[model samples]
Each structure stands twice: as structure tokens, then as C-alpha cells.
Target chain A: MRKIKMIVEYDGSNYHGFQSQKNAHTIQDTIENALYKLTGHKIPIISAGRTDRGVHALGQVIAFETEAKIPSDKFYLALNSVLPEDIRILNSKEVETDFHPRFQAIKKQYSYYIYTKDSGKTFLRKFAWCNSEPLNIDDMIKACKQFEGRHNFLSFCSSGSSVKTFERTIEVCQLQQKNAYLKFDIKANGFLYNMARIIVGTVVDVGRGKIKVNDINDIIKARDRNAAGSTAPPQGLYLMYVEY
Target chain B: MRKIKMIVEYDGSNYHGFQSQKNAHTIQDTIENALYKLTGHKIPIISAGRTDRGVHALGQVIAFETEAKIPSDKFYLALNSVLPEDIRILNSKEVETDFHPRFQAIKKQYSYYIYTKDSGKTFLRKFAWCNSEPLNIDDMIKACKQFEGRHNFLSFCSSGSSVKTFERTIEVCQLQQKNAYLKFDIKANGFLYNMARIIVGTVVDVGRGKIKVNDINDIIKARDRNAAGSTAPPQGLYLMYVEY
Candidate 1:
């Protein structure tokens, strides 16, 4: 058997999520079905990030083991020819038999986009969160800095996650504004369920003056989900990169 | 009665075209329906450009006469509340009663986006034309200059147009490349049916080495549709601005 690693990109607008489920449309099921048509075998793949519904991805990493005879480097072209237009294989290569996508990952980066125009842009409605109300960028920037460090992120995690620990190390947290759009980027060792979105929500509240900037530290220390702001919607979140 | 001139924007992926048809969904029909809901009477609207199906617009100018008591500038906000997510009124103001969107227009600008990456971008699939083949940008740029000045564009115009004159002066024709994307912008006094798309198709053909760059002038002089290249698809075309 050969181990194959691939970088995938998907819109995720019409998908339930990255993970496969019964009686639902998903990115995993669509790709796996395309793989079945290509290799004539049921190939279950593993991904580094199992993104939630409506969350897009630019460089999602996945690995799978197969007994097919096709060369690994050519897998992207072959699979893209069969896969739907919303999901595409960007790069594919053979990897060591023991190589795993999730376990050996060192860091992951995510970005959330916000359209701050008074009138929303029609072309960007599916990809960006439209917040017409004015946001204090300086306050939002100050709040982002508070998130960069090791902390117990229990306040930012949603319910129903099976993880044992709520602690994670955040390496980078920053916000950049271009024209009428604001992009929030964060890098971390790992993320709990809805951690990024919750953090963004809290930061947005700070920008809106609903919460103070210096209170982010207290929110993290509170270690309670209710202490954080509401979870931002999934459409604005994008899994940007996975580093191993 | 007040004459209202509005700048509109729309994602035309789901509509038949800008013009209203008997049984098909269109941008015009949607807006008219929205206007009827806001006002108590049936009001017809005139647009600067009747974009084809799947052709987007960022600054489409439209005018209408209404007896509604709402302020002209506030009409955008009120109409947007009732309009669908894909269509938006960007700006609205009272205009002279004789202001016609089509006949009084002095110039119009349009843009076409092309994605040249070997692998298509999932997010951009709906808005850009994806051509994996390598293109010669310099050759295409040279061909763009030939499209400037006044010339008989009958060779580039598609059939079924009712215009009496085929001569139109182009003020600007340029192509800008950013990473894997190319944007072609053109400004003209007016356009024939499918003229901009055909011009792009011909320039693309020049980039692909299918046609010589110098042959453009002769093709325009020929004044026959058979002498021109194929019509580029409508999804990549956007009515950028309409000037009066």
C-alpha cells in the first residue's frame, strides 16, 4: 500500500462539512465518491482539520492509503477531472507509510473575513460576514493582541467537544483592513470546537464597544463558555494552512 | 412624481438576464417586483445596459418614475430591505425627469476576469473564466491597443442586434495581471451586442497563438462576424460603470 498526501481547496458553501455523515451532502463524501469512481475502491481519507459547515478551506491537508497503481503526483489532475467544481485537489504526492495528517501537525492558520461596507457587496455575500455597523479597528487590534499566548480557552470553546484539555498555545493573532474588508488571522497549535469563531465574536464585541479591550484576559481566565461572546457565523471562517 | 436614478449591483448567476421575459426570472423583473411592493403602482425601469445571463454588474445605472413618498436617497435602504441577497441598490437620488439611463449615457466601462492557474480556484469559479493553458500577456496587451479608436465593429458584434451603426470609439482598453488572475477593462462610447465578449475572445485567441496580434485591425475592417473569434462566456463579464 502507498500513502498519499494531498492539499485540497473547497468553497464549502453547499456542503454540510468536511466529515462524511449519513443522509447528508459533505465534501468528504463527494471526494470519496469521486475516488471510488477513479480507483474502483472505497478509500477512506483522513484530514488534518475537520472544518464545520459553511467553513471554507484554502490549503486543507489530507492523507490516505491505497493499493491503486496510479502515480501519486498525477492524482490531483485525475481526481479533479472527476470531482465537482466546488472541491479541487491542488497538489498530491506520495508520503512515508507512517505519515499522518493530523497527529504530526505543528500549527494551523485560519482567517475570517468581515465586510464593513454600509451597503453589502452582492458578490461577497457568500464568503464574507457583513457587519454594516461601524467597528473600532483600533480596539479590535488591541483585543487581538490579548489572544496571542498560551491560555485555557474553555471560554471560547463550544459544547459537545470530546477533548480532555482546554489549554492551547496561540502563536499569532492579528487583524488587517483593506478597503471595506477586515481580515482576522490566527495561528495556533490546535483549536477546540468553534474556538476561532468565538474568539472573533469576542473581539468583534470589543470593536463594537460592547466589551472592553482589556477584558479579553479576564474572559480567557473565566474558563466558562458564557463569558465569551456569541459564536460568529461559519461562512466567514477559512482554514488557511496546515503546517506539519 | 419623482425620477429616481440608482446605481445597482447584482450577482447574475441565477437570473436569465437583465431584461424581463415572460416566464423567466431576471434582474429587471425582480427589481420591478420589489419596487411594486414598495410603491403601490406598477413602475417600469430603464437600464444603461441589458447584461446577458450570468453577467454580473457593479455599477449598472437604472432610472424609474415613481409616486412613492419616500426620499430618493432613502430608496436604496428601503428597497434593499425587500430585495433578495443577490441584488442590491448601491445608490439612489432624484434625477431630471428627462434623464434616460440608456440614451443619455456618454460612456460605459466593463471588466472581464480570467483565471490562468493550472488548478482552478474553487471560490473564483463563479466569477472568473478559468483557462489552464498558458497565455502570452505581452501579445494580448498589444492586441488591446488595436481595439482602441473608432472602427466598424460589425465583425465583433453577434447577430440579433438592432443597432443601426457599427462604429464606436473605445477610450481605453488594457489588461492587468495580478498573480494568477488577469483583469481586462474597456471603456467605450457604446457597445454592440456581444462586442466586449467577442473582443476579449479575440484577444485571448491572440494570447493563445491561435490568431496573430496584427490580424485584429484587418478583422475589424472586414466587418464580417466570421472573421472574429468566438464569444467569451458571460459569467466573467461585469458591467463596471455607466457614465452620463
Candidate 2:
């Protein structure tokens, strides 16, 4: 048996999410199905994180144990041949048997894209959040500084998450404006359920004047989900990469 | 009655082309239905050009005569409310009553995008053509100069097209590479059925060494559909705009 790690890219708009369900189609299920067809393995492949429905990924990481004789480099080509067009294996390699995608991951990067009413990127609707008005970029950028460093991000996490703790270190939080789009890029040691999305929502609210920028400190200190702004829609959130 | 002209954008993946047909969900029918709901007019819209199935458009022009009380600018918002998410009216204005979208159009700009195997833009599979090997962009750009200026484009048009004349003036033809994407932008006075796609296919063939760059002039002069390379797929083609 050999352990393998793969970087995957997927347009998650058509998927129900990352985790497999009984009837719905999920990214995890689609990849597992393809893997079964290729290697006849039935075990669940471990992922760095489980994404919500409609959330896309650029460099999502996954690991699995297999005994197939295929070479490491050929694995991506083989998997991509059998996988759907929306999901592709970007790269693959053999890893140590003890490697765990989640536990061994040091940091993760995510990006959120927003299209305001003034922009006309209609084809990117599935990959971006479309709002009625353009968010104030200046205010959003200022509020991003509040998210830097370690914090108990329970206020940014969704309810029903049974994690042991909400403490996470945000290494970077940036807002970039390119033409008609506002992109939010964030890097963190680890994220709670929907933490990145909630942070985006809070920043957007700050830009919209619905939430004060200084109030972000209190929201993190409160450690209450209701203390933060609403969780942004899943479509705009992207799992950019995982650093191991 | 007012002649309303609108610049529209759409993701053509789900559409059965730009023309209306029985038992098909076309962009034309969808827009007509939305217009009918917004206004009581059941008249069909006239478009600058009819796009085949799965061909996208960023600034497709359409015109229709309406007696609705809604202002010209407000029509876009009202129609978009009833239209599908993939289709959007970018702009609307009042046009001359006798102006015909096709007959009065002077030029049109179209682009074809190719995602090379090296790029991980797998998310754009539905909107671009993906190829494994890298295409020779330098040779392709050189061949583009041969396409500039007026010529009989019969060889570059698909069969079964019965146009009055095959002469069309090519204003510009350029192939540009950005990262892993190859974009072919062309401006022409007019195009025959699948003309732009056939031209792109020939250019791609030239890049692959299947056809010589110097052979393009002879192919255009042949005035035979068989003289050109195969027609490229529709998904990669985008109608950028129509100049009136």
C-alpha cells in the first residue's frame, strides 16, 4: 500500500458540498467514485477541509492510501480522464504513509470574489458574489487589519460546529480591487466552520456602513456567532491552497 | 412605439443558441419571454448575429420595437428581474425606428479562448477549449496578418451556408497569449455560418504544424469549405460586440 497526495481544482457550483451524502452529489463523492473506478478503492479520501455547497477550490488537498501500480505522476492524468470536467486533479505525488491532510496542514489560503451591480462579468456569476452596490473598498481594507493575528473566531463560525476550540491565527487579510472586482485573500493557521465567509460578510457590512470597523474587535472578543455579521454566500468563497 | 437596443451578456452553456426554435430553450426565446412579461409585447427580438449552441456573448446586440411605458434604461432592470441569472442586459437605449440589428451592423468583434494544459484554470472548461500540448502562438500570430483586409471567406465558412456573397472585410486578426490562455480576437465586417470558428480552427492547425502558415492565403483563395481546417467547437467562441 502507498499513500498519495493530490492537489485538486473544482467548480463547486454543481456540487452539494465536499462531504458525501446519501442521495446528493458532492465533490468528495465524485472524486471517490472516480478513484473507485480507477483503483477499486472504497475508502473515503481525506481532505484538508470540507467546503460548503457552491464554494469553489483552486488547490484543495486530498490524501488516500492505494495499492495501484500506476506511477505518481500518471495518477493525475488517470484521475482527470475519468473525472468530470468541473473537477480536475492538478497534481499528484506519493506521500509518507503517516501523512494526514488535515492534521499535518500548517496553513490554508482562501479568496472571496465580489461583483457589484456596475460590473458585467455575467459568466462569472457562479464563481462570485453579486451585490446590488459596490462595497466601499477603503473601509473594507481598513477592517481587514482587525482580522490579522490570533483570535477566538467563534463569532465568525457557524452554529452547530462541535469543534474543541475556535482559536486560529490569521497571518494575512487583504482586499484587492482589480477593475470591477473586489477580491479578499486570507491566510490562516486554521479556520472554523464558515469563518472566512463570515469575515468577508463582516467586512462587506463594514463597507456598507452596516457594521462599524472598530466594532470588529468586540465581535472577536465576544466569541459569539451573533456578534459577527452574516455569513457570506458560499459561491464567492474559494479554497485557494493548503500549506503543509 | 420605440426601437429599444440592448447590449446583452450570457453564459451559453445552458442555452440552445441565440435563435428561437421549437422544443428548445434558446437565448432569443428566453429574452422574448422576459420582454413579454415585462411588457405586453410578444414580438420577437432581432439580434446582430445568431450564435450557435454553447457560444457565449459579452456584448451581443439586440433590438425590438416596444410600446411599453417603461423608460429605456429602466427596461434593463425590469427585464433582468424576469430573466434567468445567466442572461443579463448590460445596457439599453432607444434606437432609430428603421435601424436593423443585422442589416445596419458595420462590424463585429469575436474572441476564442484556449486553456492550455499547463494552466490550472479547469474551472473555465465550460467557457474555453482545453488542449494538452502547447500551441505555437508565434506562428499563429504571423498567420493572422494574412487574414487582415478584404477577402472571399468562403473557405473559412461551414457548409450549408447559402449567403448572397462570400466577400468580407477583415479589420483585425490577432492571437495573444496570457499565461496559459491563448485568445484569438478578430474584427470583421461580416461572417458566414461558423466562419469565425473555422478561422480559429485553421489558425490552431497552423500552430500545431498540421498546416503551414503560408498556406492560409491559398486556403482563403480556394473558395471551398474543404480547403480550411475543421470547425472549432462552439464553447470557446464569444461574440464580443457589434459595431453599428
**Relative to the true structure, how large is the alpha-carbon lDDT of every model?**
0.93, 0.90
Which portions of model 1 miss their true places by more than 4 Å? A118-120, B118-120
TM-score of candidate 2 restricted to chain B? 0.97
Output the lDDT of residue A148, model 2. 100
- Candidate 2: segments with Cα more than 4 A from true spot: A117-119, B117-119
Q: Give the clashing residue pairs of candidate 1, or none.
A: none
- Top model number, DockQ: 2
Chain A, model 1: TM: 0.98
**What is the Å distance of residue A12 in model 2 from its true position?**
0.3
